[model samples]
Target: MKANETIIVEEQLSAPISVVWDAITNLNSMKKWFFNNIPSFKSEVGFKTQFNVKSEERNFLHLWEIIEVVPSKKIVYNWKYAEYSGNSLVYFELFENINNTTKIKLTCKITESFSDDIPEFKTESCRGGWNYFIKQNLKNYLENS
Candidate 1:
């Protein structure tokens, strides 16, 4: 509801930071869990990529630009939809936990608000999407791989 809201999802993966970072930064690994059709991705700042995600019969053009990257630690990107006026920042942070476990924190910060009529742009939907990815999808991929 708020103009600038942040959706944060954290998960402890039973893998090392390098593995988790690879999964997040590497395009090949990302396709297995994240956007399967991500055309291209690079960890360098200013790198950009775009992909289309279909939801409820509507196609959303996901526009992403890498803003920052700290090797094996953090990656931040400016995320927006071509069909929407709003934009957001998606941050992935990896923390080395005990016993070879890594803690991954995903933060999606809404820098600008989109129209309320679009349900998918709502904060609740954004939070739910991130939760599903970090808690279920990514978690399963890391643990099972």
Candidate 2:
């Protein structure tokens, strides 16, 4: 079995904590950037949401189970794909800074056994992708909207 490794990404947003929280918890707001309009998410704890993700040559039907949710503060989920043998945890934390801005932290950990055969194992792609999605796309959307 492969031991899990966690990746954390943090960003300081110019938007207020409430505004940033709304952007993440509100389905419509999330659709604009996070899931590219294909995610129907329920922010309630224990609810499961499905998302359709597509790249240049492949499409994925991803399922996420909400594990923890605290309004305007934290959210956590379990993530897995149909073809993958491993499971992952995704966490989101929001902190209110002294400047009235929000500091968003996202962390993910993969728990599946990974070998050299799995291309995603030990690849920087996953972290890079999340960085783009959260720091660039989501951040821009929340700040601008």
lDDT of each: 0.91, 0.79
How well is each residue in 29-132 modelled by candidate 2, as lDDT tens digits? 88787876544777888888776666555455687898999999999988876655667888989999988899999998877654545545444777887899
Cα RMSD for candidates in order: 0.9, 2.2
Write candidate 1's Cα lDDT for 49-142 as tens digits. Answer: 9999999888899999999999999999999989878888899999999999999999988888877888888778888999999999999999
Tell me the spans in candidate 1 whose CA falls farther than 4 Å from its real position.
none
In order of listing, the candidates' clash counts read 0, 0
TM-score of each: 0.97, 0.88
TM-score between candidate 2 and the true structure? 0.88
By lDDT, who's the top model here? Answer: 1
